[model samples]
Target: MRAVIQRARDAKVTVQGEVVGEIRDGFVILLGVTHDDTIEDAEYLANKIVHLRVFEDENEKMNLSLKDVGGDILSISQFTLYGDTRKGRRPNFMQAARPEQANTLYEQFNNLIKNEGINIATGEFGAMMDVTLTNVGPVTLILDSKEK
Candidate 1:
């Protein structure tokens, strides 16, 4: 499992010109699943992301977690994160998990976040979504469960 986490002032996902998910003052999380990803991976990332202290404190230090700031999450399933660009003109998606497996893990991940008591909005799984966000501080981070 992997994720691209971006702090945002606001974020939303649209599908076929209809808003699917939206949030304010939180994170826009682009999540990806690989063939070997498991529930443990989803759990690890959910715990880490919600508790991550990247938001600013009263003194302007990056010391507040998402919970501290009452932030929301706009979660989106992104299979292309695993696209392999090494030896071909076209990106290879061999490392991405199959749709069924990916969607299962993706839902589990979102449930874990919701269980943490943080409000979470999500893009439709397996859909062509248009996501927009105002990235606060332009702060972005990448996390891979396998790396941890």
Candidate 2:
């Protein structure tokens, strides 16, 4: 499992001109699942993300977690995060999990986040979406379950 976590002032996902998910002052999480990803990976990421201190404190230091700032989350399943360009020009998605597997884990991940008592919005699992966000502090992090 992998994720590109971005701090945002606000974020939204639209499918065919219809808003699917939206959030304010929180994270826009681009999540990806690989063939070997499991529920434990999803749970680990959810916990890590919740505890991450990326927001600023009264001292202007990055000391506040998502919970501390009362932020919402917009999670989007993005299999393309595993697009491998190591070979030819065309990107290969061989490392990405099948749609069914990916969707299952993705939902599990969202559930874990919600269980943590934080509000979470989500994009359509397998739809073409247009996501827009106002990035805050331009803070971003790439997280991989294997790394932990």
Candidate 3:
């Protein structure tokens, strides 16, 4: 499992011109699941994201976690994150998990966040989505379950 976590002032996902999910002062998490991903991977990434200290403190220091700032999360499934472009002009997604497995892990990840007592919004899994966000400080971080 992997996630691109971006701090945003607000974020929303739209599908077929209908808003599917939205959030304010939170994170826009683009998540990807690999063939090797399991529930443990989902849980680890979710916990890391929620506790990441990317938010600023009262003294203007980047010292506050999302939980400390009372923020929400907007999770979006993005299998393309596994696209391997090293070989040729075209990217390959062989490392990405099958839709069935990916969707299950994605749902579990969202549930993990929600179980943390924070509001969590999500884009439709496997749907074409248009995501919009006002990135706060343009703060972005990438987390991969394989790393730790």
Candidate 4:
């Protein structure tokens, strides 16, 4: 499992010109699943992301967690994060999990976050989505379960 977390002042996802999910004062999460990912991987990431202290305090120090600031999450399933482009003109998706497995883990990941009492808005899984966001602080971080 991998997550690309972006701090966003506001964000939205649209499919076929219809807004499916939206949030304000939150993180836009692009989540990916690999073949070997398990519930434990999803659990680790959900715990980390909710507790990540990247928000600023009164002294302008980054010391506030998303839970501390009452933030939401816009979660999107992104299989392309695992695209391997090492030796070919075309990116290879062999590292990405199959759709069924990916979707199962993806949903479980979202549920784990939700269990923490944070609001979650999600893009339709496997859909062609257009995402828009105002990336607050332009702060972006990538996390991989395999690396931990």
Candidate 5:
């Protein structure tokens, strides 16, 4: 499992011109699941994201976690994160999990985040989505279960 976490002042996801999910003063998470990902991976990534100290503190230093600032999360499924372009002009997604498995893990990841006692919003899994966000401090971080 992997996630690209961006601190945002606000974020929303739209599908077919209908807003599916939205949040304010939170994280815009682009989540990816791989063939090897399991519930454990989902849990780990969720925990790390919520506890990550990317928000600023009293002295303008980045020291406040999402939990500390009472923030929400907007999670979006993005299997393309696994795309490999090392071979040629085209990218391969062989490392990404099948839709069935990916969807299950994606749901699990979102549920885990919700269970963390924070508000959570999500984009439709496997759907074409348009995501909008006002990135805060332009703070972005990548989390991968394999790296931990």
Candidate 6:
């Protein structure tokens, strides 16, 4: 599993000209799943993102977790994160999981984060989505279960 986490002042997802999910003062997560990903991978990434201390504290130090600042999340399924372009111009998506499996892990990851008492809004899985966000501090982080 891999996740690109962006600190957002506000974020929203739209499908077919209608809003699907949105959040304020939280994270905009582009989550990806691989063929080998399991519940463990989902759990690891979710925990890391939620506890990540990128938000600034009163002293202007980046030391506050999402929980500390009472933030929400806009989670989106993004299999394209596994796009591999080492060879040709077209990227290969062979590493990405099948939709059935990927969606399961994706849902599991979201449920885990929500279980932590943080509010979560999600884009429709496998749908063509338009996402917009005000990236606060321009703070972005990438988390990969394999990196651990």
Per residue, candidate 3 scores C-alpha lDDT tens digits across 53-74 of 9999989999999999999999
* C-alpha RMSD of each candidate structure in angstroms: 0.5, 0.5, 0.6, 0.5, 0.7, 0.5
lDDT of model 3 at position 8: 96
Question: Which is superior by TM-score, 2 or 5?
Answer: 2
Task: Show where candidate 5 strays beyond 4 Å.
Answer: none
Predicted structure 5, TM vs. truth: 0.98
lDDT of 5 by residue, 1-148 (tens): 9899999999999999999999999999999999999999999998899899989999999999999999999999999999999999999999999999999999999999999998999999989999999998899888899999
**lDDT of candidate 2 at residue 72, scale 0 to 100:** 95
lDDT of 1 at 104: 99
Candidate 4 lDDT, 1-148, residue by residue in tens: 9999999999999999999999999899999999999999999999999999999999999999999999999999999999999986999999999999999999999999999999999999999999999999989999998888
The count of residue-pair clashes in candidate 4 stands at 0
- Error at 141, model 1, angstroms: 0.3
Model 2 per-residue lDDT tens digits across residues 1-148: 9999999999999999999999999999999999999999999999999999999999999999999999999999999999999999999999999999999999999999999999999999999999999998899999999998
Q: List pairs with backbone clashes in candidate 2.
A: none
Report how far residue 133 has shifted in candidate 4, in Å: 0.3
Residue 37 local lDDT, model 1: 96
Q: What are the TM-scores, per candidate, against the unseen true structure?
A: 0.99, 0.99, 0.98, 0.99, 0.98, 0.99
lDDT values for all models: 0.98, 0.98, 0.95, 0.97, 0.95, 0.96
Please write out the lDDT profile of model 1 over residues 94-148, one tens digit for every residue: 9999999999999999999999999999999999999999999989999999998
Q: What residue runs in model 2 are displaced by over 4 Å at the alpha carbon?
A: none
lDDT comparing candidate 3 with the true structure: 0.95
